[model samples]
Target chain A: MPSELELQISPIVQESLVHNSRTLQNLQSLTASLFGVSAGILGLESYDGFLFYLAFSLLTSALFYLVRVAPSSLTAGPRYFRGPFEFWAGGLMNGLAGFILTWTLFYGLVRA
Target chain B: MTWISKSITTLGGLLLAHACYSAREHSALQSLRAASAASLTSLPSVTTSLPLDIIIETIVATFIILLGLVLGTRPLRPIEWRVWAGKIEREGEEGFIDGAGEVNKDYMGNPFSALESRPNFVDIRKQRREFAEWVKKGG
Candidate 1:
């Protein structure tokens, strides 16, 4: 989190912040369901399934950074995101429900 | 660029669907075999997991889809006010175009444009002269 003084020194654009976060959230939610489908096809269960979700979601963040954030933000460090945590791990909880929903549906479909 | 991502995503979806179908068939075949074996003898039937090929296909397809999705996402804007304003000044409308080659609806152009083109500073006589010349030339 940036200090109030730091924020005042360099004011943030609220519209840009919202745009960036919304883009990331959209990608995370879409890929979370994709991961779940693959996990289901692999017959992963319980902890294994959750672990698969964790690993792949992290991979998604890394790929997103490489493709988008890293190109323009090499020197200043992710100008679109507020902090490292927001860029990397913020979407974990946002997509968990969608992941589980598709996981169980596909798991049952494949097994049945 | 948009088409590239869309095609890649479609290809990945096809591969994933095929893998899912293969896994389903494999499980169904295993269950059928298990039932036959159980009826034929007293020994318990062995359960088989998905083939390695299917697992690999599923994982690879997922990765391709992830790449496509990341590529498909809209370009992000700088969060800092100065950086954002500078981008608008430097690139104008070109800076805010989306994947479809259209200007973003939210793009309002230069924020300080009102100050730059204040109506109060306009030369009324200069505008009236231009309008009169146009009328005289045609009408």
Candidate 2:
């Protein structure tokens, strides 16, 4: 039996939600790696490298909202952002591990 | 691909990984020498001699891993109304519901509208008894 919550959401809305999440994951991971490479090449130290990653990943999230999510989703939901944590802040945290991994590897390389 | 093909590919990858690992170990000493000469940081250098090469390697590895994640996984199948509706209507030769199911006989009216005017427990029991008789009679 379908629950009241399940019955309320249309199939199209479900599909859109899934699609948005997949796109966001791809964007976040890719940008995190790229940011790591830039930090490594620039020879940024520990604190500065992390700061750079945080800033860039937030930028990626903002771009994702403006370009892909805003026009289609603005009128439908009660939430300000499409997903949780309101875009930039959430994506920055989500991508932090990936960013750190690449950043550390490259930092070791350039600084050494 | 088939299981055999996938296993073969995995074995090939394992071989490549082993080879790279051995090569990386051999080059580590040389890289350390290069690292010590470069800057003030005492962090150990990886396989590459130059910083640019390391950056490029990181980028390429990221792209490859991202590509594998996107394409290597099985895609999700979304549930759609039309597909289930077609199965209910028996419009095609093949559908999700099999012939053994009791629902093979199509309902005459919109089924959802009937939800508001549903049969009571007594009515349902009486209908079940009638269905059992019909099955016994091979109808």
Candidate 3:
């Protein structure tokens, strides 16, 4: 069930969904590569490497929102964010697998 | 055609990866020679190779390039009418009625008669008149 806040905002549109998904994909891929580089440089290992990725992915999501979204209206309409999940924190979960793949590759290469 | 294109793309990607790996290997060998010139005998010669960073970067860059090429080359299919109509209606700030349905219904009953009648020629004189009217009105 959608919350009252979700109802107050404009309904999600297909075009916006398509556009946002493409943007999210680009962000995930770029951030994944960056996370790999940082992890390799920092010499993080095993569990610590994973933790670094988690923290950075969330940070990337926040930064993406602040840079791309927050300047616009928040609660009014489709002119702002796509939806609550996309606007706030869904990018972190979306980026996780890509981040892990790159982080592992970098960690193995650097530590080797 | 799609299958052929997919196969070609796969082959191209493999060739690109192989070419990138060989180029990196050659550069690494050259760098090793340059490093040896400074009397760095302590450096491991036999195991000398491209750094992990470089290898990862080459692979990632190649992958992204190939992915972009594949995606970019794929033919764009026509948008569905409902989706197109919805977009048009939204932009126009109006409700959409399926105009095609009315056309189809009319054409279905008298298909042969409609096919027999040809469309009129371009009305150049009327267009000139409209342009003259526009100029007269300071449009």
The order by descending lDDT is 1, 2, 3
Better of 2 and 3 by DockQ: 2
TM-score of each: 0.93, 0.40, 0.41
Show where candidate 1 strays beyond 4 Å: B119-139
> Candidate 2 falls in which docking quality class?
incorrect
Q: Model 3, range A1-112, lDDT digits (tens) per residue?
A: 4476764553444543454465656666666665665555344568876787677666655655554455443553124344466645665666667766766675454444
What ranges in model 2 sit over 4 Å off? A1-12, A73-86, B1-139
Model 2 clash tally, residue pairs: 0
Task: Tell me the deviation in Å of residue B127 in model 1.
Answer: 5.4
* Best candidate, DockQ: 1
Docking class of 1: high
Write candidate 2's Cα lDDT for A7-79 as tens digits: 4663323542454466577668766766775565455686888887777666665655554456545775222
**Number of the predicted model whose lDDT against the real structure is largest:** 1
Candidate 3 lDDT by residue in tens digits, B9-86: 466556544544554455656666867864766655454444566455544543443343333321111122343334
Task: Please give the lDDT score for candidate 2.
Answer: 0.51
DockQ of 1: 0.86
What tens digits encode model 2's per-residue C-alpha lDDT throughout B1-139? 2344345435544543443343344356666676686686666555444345544454344334333333332222123444334333553323322223333233333324456466552478788999999999999
Question: Of the candidates numbered 1 and 2, which has the greater TM-score value?
Answer: 1
